[model samples]
Target chain A: MRERFITLTSPVVPLERDNVDTDQIIPARFLKATSREGFGDKLFHDWRYDSAGCPRPDFVLNDPTHRGTILAAGKNFGCGSSREHAAWAIRGAGFRAVLSPRFADIFRENALNNGLLPVQLPAPFLERVFTVTRERPEAAVTVDLERQEVRFEGETAPFDIPPYRKRCLLQGFDDIDYLLSIRDKIILFEKQHAL
Target chain B: MNTLFDKIWDAHVVEALPGDTHVLYIDRQYIHEVTSPQAFEGLRRRGVPLFRPGQVTAIPDHNIPTLCQHLPVADPLSRAQLDTLERNCVAHDISLFRIGTPHHGIVHVAGPESGLTLPGMTIVCGDSHTSTHGALGCVAFGIGTSEVEMALATQCILQPKPRPARVRVEGRLPAGTCAKDLILHVISRIGTAGGTGYFVEFAGTAIRALSLEARMTVCNMSIEMGARGGMIAPDDATFDYLRDRPFAPRGAAWERAIERWRALPSDDDARFDAEFTFDAGEIAPMITYGTNPATGIPVTATIPPAADPQALAYMGLHAGEPLVGKRVDHVFVGSCTNGRLEDLRAFASLVKGKRRAPGVTAWIVPGSQEVERRAIAEGVRDTLEAAGFVLRQPGCSACLAMNEDKVPPGKYCVATSNRNFEGRQGPGARTFLAGPLVAAAAAVTGEIRDPRELM
Candidate 1:
């Protein structure tokens, strides 16, 4: 079973660009592997590496000073393509939560299923977080799923997460477990609504 | 008052849990190579058998080589993935459509042409283009591997109900434009995040006038604008497209199916969470200049001055410059979005007598074996070959560059496929997403030109 995600307080890696798509998270070329693990090295493959396979220093992940467990990105994070590898890569790279003003629907679902916390804060709070993190790389932000709030530098903002998702994250529950428990209902429904 | 989305979604609800989540039963689940291996592995690890194996269909498309289907795949990794899919299907007793079979193609294309996608059914696949199936008026959307495993184990998924939105495009499309242009124009108006939490429905006179295949082209790219999925109410056009296909109902059953389908449209007083209306006459031949599909403008317009500079640098284009006269290095006209037979005909009609440009390399691929067969039988293939375009075998070629159709680094391609994401075609490749006519125009002129001028 994956680790339970309850609350996290850690420094963040800020990606200020909006519409950071899945292709930029994990390119199409790295998707040939059957296993979901071992993708941490390939996360953001194109943006992190040059043609020679050398790390590009200008990229955020390449910088040692900006290490963290949370990825604070601009709006529309995880747009384009429904590849869960993007979520897998982010988790494999050791991040626990993503703080964005918005997230694409499929990606949000994938992130939740795979144990990545997607925190949807307001745009103004995100702007403050970006500004504060830029000035102090080691500054930490706290995400409390139970309280449904994000706290940073004496400022706290309420975020919205469905109660079902919150319970699953708090207890390390899997959707498959819930789905498998209700097999009889599924069969009954299928028999009644035979297409 | 019920919307079409509500009619389909409510019927498929097996149970409703708290927090607005539902255990939605999926009628059809299509599996492909790239995303299904892990899902099958999930089943094996849990030691559970598939609940309804017959409801699932496996077809490998993403990583398969578009050329030489009979030959063994050269890439060891790609070959292993394909082999894994075949083995998994065999083990689970699920139906498989391997390469070289008459039924093989991209799942989105193969599903509709085989009549497996019908009105009011809930469909799903691991790939995002599963939204393409919603063109038949189904509540179809994409899922990840874990959800794929959930569907396999129980044929049901726990989903939070998405709100409904309506985009009504009225009036007739201008002569030079088609469904692709209309969708691109809509995406341009509504930025990538505009439809984030809603399932959008296409309505009004203009959408009703499009053919079934053309409607698929519109719904296929709904994800590009962040919608959960897109659909059009199943009409006579949709029924006619499915009437005689192999998997469709026949005789008395066909009549019954039509009777049910006729009730699938929204009622006159149905209300939506959001509504947007556009005049089809305002849309022109469209093209995307940036990395995302939403960064689109008319073919005759200059790049917006507010365009992202980093995106422009990566595309080797600059703001305040006319996109019309830019040189193009490659032209690709195939994908689940616009790779149907109708798309091929639109391409062939424009490039009929024109010679290929001196420096442009063009690849014309069919979406499915059925499309390929009809393209040849109807002389579209002959016309294309005469215009210096080679018709490649059917697959998702050049759309995501999973196979041998990668555009070289730093080269520009005018393509009719969806998603112009950076490195989507290949490493360092720049793509301009457009309809088939725009791609054909670039193929003949060796540059970006408004397809309207050519017509």
Candidate 2:
């Protein structure tokens, strides 16, 4: 499926919790959906909403004052389960980028494939974003997948994404596009091996 | 000198790309209800035909209720996910182990027992515990859904190499210690992030002596410590287990396969990026008192003061408190981690003459139809039933909060499954991971008692 260039320009919300697992991101109870869409409503389901389905005001995601398209969490964000629903929910909830010190391996790939950019920022930069966004709730941050750099508060820092992943995010090209492009090679290999 | 990992990995590399990336040729792909729907939908939308449909296996484990297998799934969402898998498997002409089938079970359990996972092969599943196949000396790792799409379309995946960590364990374990305890001890010594960016090779005599189910239990939790996966070089024990499986090679072909498998072990001169050693003698019947699996300790040990505050608060435990006698409302003995025949037998042996504690709810699920059948054949189910513990149908039940078997919020459950992450079993649910024997002990005693105490 064709995705759009993921350029984020918005304030970021802090999920300050450490080792935020995929089950915590989107509870397993809500993972029964066949389609990936409509997961935004259930994003952070247990934390963002209560037993009665009432939004928890204390939760950062539901706090009307801390609105943004990016979620900033601590280390090992999206760590536990490999369910891609966590990524779908993150993207579905209008977040284009998740700024973290480091991302759990699989979640990073899942987020990138679904058009949600997982930006690895230095500890200081992460702190700066938290400070800037808190002092100025209207603070705007930018993530440029093409340049592999993130801009915030008049400063920019470089991050690394595989060249192919960068190209996909920039061109709205899914990894499948590359696989499709290399179809002849795959066919040749399979035929050669009689696989 | 090549490690077992490198040998299998080198052969699977179909193409090398710039920036240290390669396209890995996948030999087997397993899918389940939760993470696979999106990938199948993507394949449908992109009009990508699966390159090797015959090598793929699809099942519904995460969403199926452990009870009432003959009836349609009652929950609409569960029904929808299962229906989607059934529909996609039919539409794509892929093999499926739908509920009630002899082959039906957890994806990780069903594949290997059916001889679908073999040595010297590369396997990927949408579920994290796919590492369980590594016990057979296969290079099996979990992939995200999009990567699943890549494997489906081309029977390959774009990948970067992972560093190998040789985790060597020496000494014979005390009788009560199971594979679950051995792995918990490993995770505790190395925090949850210890194996990040690495594939762990669990080696040494202690790992070698374990039965296939036990080795699988150890490998199945590789993801809990953030490993790409874990493997044990397949040996005579692995060969003996695979001999009579339906999909396994027959007669002379079996000998040929054994010859190939024999050559797959690491060379003596092989090196790893990092090395860790644990003495099996020190490993006790373990349980997680905190939220993550890495925060576990022997059941006899006191809860650490440094346990995660959030975990402590959610679990309603005080620092330095004894975990024993902390009333457990639920005792779950199932999941890819400990839902096999051996796990059921362990539970049965523990609870044979005693009835389940009135306050504790015991949920016992077999890992596969074969395991379920064997449990009945061995009268393990009858033993469990006599002890007032029902042997439910096979599925990944209560391992995560996906299915109907969720522990009610604020309830305490001692589970034999992998993760004990906060809210893993349900919202506000406190999970303590233990071996099946430990879980059985807790069920009969209605507390976090050591399995050795009962033995």
Best by lDDT: 1
- B204 Cα displacement, candidate 1 (Å): 0.8
lDDT of each: 0.93, 0.87
DockQ, each predicted model: 0.86, 0.65
| After superposition, candidate 1 runs with Cα above 4 Å error | none
- Over the stretch B1-455, how does candidate 2's per-residue lDDT look in tens digits? 89999999888776777766678888889988888888888888877787788988898899888998999889898898888889989988899987999988998888889988888889999878898999999889988888998999988888878888899999999998899999999999987877887888999989998999999999998888888899999899999988889888889889888998999999999989989999999999998888888988999899987888888888898889898888999999999999999999888899989989998988999999989999999899999989998999999989985888989989999999998887888888899999988999999988888888797
Residue B156 CA error for candidate 2 (Å)? 1.5
Q: Which DockQ value does candidate 1 get? A: 0.86
Q: What TM-score, computed on C-alpha atoms, does each candidate reach?
A: 0.99, 0.97
